[model samples]
Target: MPPRTIKAAIQDALEDLPEKKLDKFRSALLDRREEPRVKMNSVEGKDYITIAQVLVSTFTEPRALRITLELLREIGCSEEAERLGELPHEPKRISVISISQSIFAHGPSAGASAGRYMSGDKHFVDKHRTALIQRVSTVPSLLDELLGRGVIKQEGYNTIMRTNQEKMKELYAGPLNACGPDEKDTFYHILNQLEPYLILELKSTK
Candidate 1:
């Protein structure tokens, strides 16, 4: 028999869940502040199979399952993640929790690859990842700011939305990861506007 694909895994994971739980799962995916968010509407009245289809189509197979697991955790359905994990899977795809590193992965130092110096502002964001994750809350606003500043486009916004784990995590993984010094400056400025107190505290601690 072929190994269980992410779609099969999702069907299995959600098969036994009650209506309330399923609704919670659906709502967690849809709670993107406003305008329903891209691709979210497809899951509105979708069944597990359809929902899984949408996820697979949007984020590809591996990321689809990761997003499902994250959504399970987000909606207090952690046990669902475990159930999903128990299903047979494709060969050696990192087992479960295949999201590949947490939000604050101390990624490669900026200067390492190209021998280019990492800028001070970018360094600030990198150095303070932990504090930023814990303290930042004006996430939707921050995303808007980043988008308005051209730091991230619509696809970037949607990707971050799909990967649920405190908006800060998504921010780090999506746009912030690719941001240049000028973009990082814009990010920092937005932080000041949306999380003034937290930024102030973090800066003082530096």
Candidate 2:
């Protein structure tokens, strides 16, 4: 496997702790009533890595790490959160902010969870890759639109049609990772139309 990125390194630290502490970490993450509220949940009995992956998917690396640190400190793991916080930087990428995205800005829990750390930057398709993979179906209609918009060609459309996992792989490898901002924006728009509730749910979580 490739070397773990800093974000993974920070999250994976939960693996070294006792199951009890990991439970607290997971609880802290799920308390939608709290600060740094991220809209996410891990199935009961999921492993630490699974919980960590869930966290990563719910926020950008910087925000994810920040929330992780605060939760760790809350659960009396300040030293660990501190150490993880020292990791240098996230690989820089250009962020495309558009006015059309404002549609998903308002969340259901805006009254309880609206805080400084609430995610505004995590709406785009690229930022929430794992969440989409986990929640969205094959979405052949979405694939059709992607093809119609030239975001994916015949071959990519066929490959991605196999399963959500395959679709996410193809999209990340071929489009979200390889294409420019315009294509990515198109993908996000298509996703919002197809999975409006899920998209809104995720956008509000951060």
Highest-scoring model, lDDT: 1
Error of 1 at 81 (Å): 0.7
Model 2: what TM-score? 0.40
lDDT of 1 by residue, 1-206 (tens): 66767777877777767888988888876764422243656887778778777777766676566567656766777687767755665223321111112111333332224322234544667778876875565567677756755678877655445322467787787778887754565566556554544554566564
Position 163, candidate 1: lDDT: 27
Candidate 1 backbone collisions, by pair: none
CA deviation > 4 Å runs, candidate 2 = 1-123, 156-161
TM-score of each: 0.44, 0.40
Tens digit of lDDT per residue, candidate 2, span 1-206? Answer: 56567557765678776889887887777874534455544535778777677767766555566566657876998678656655544232222223123322443222123312223464267677777775564266677776766667886444625566677776677655776554555566666655544666677765
Error of model 2, residue 67, in angstroms: 26
User: Model 1 lDDT vs. the true structure?
Assistant: 0.61
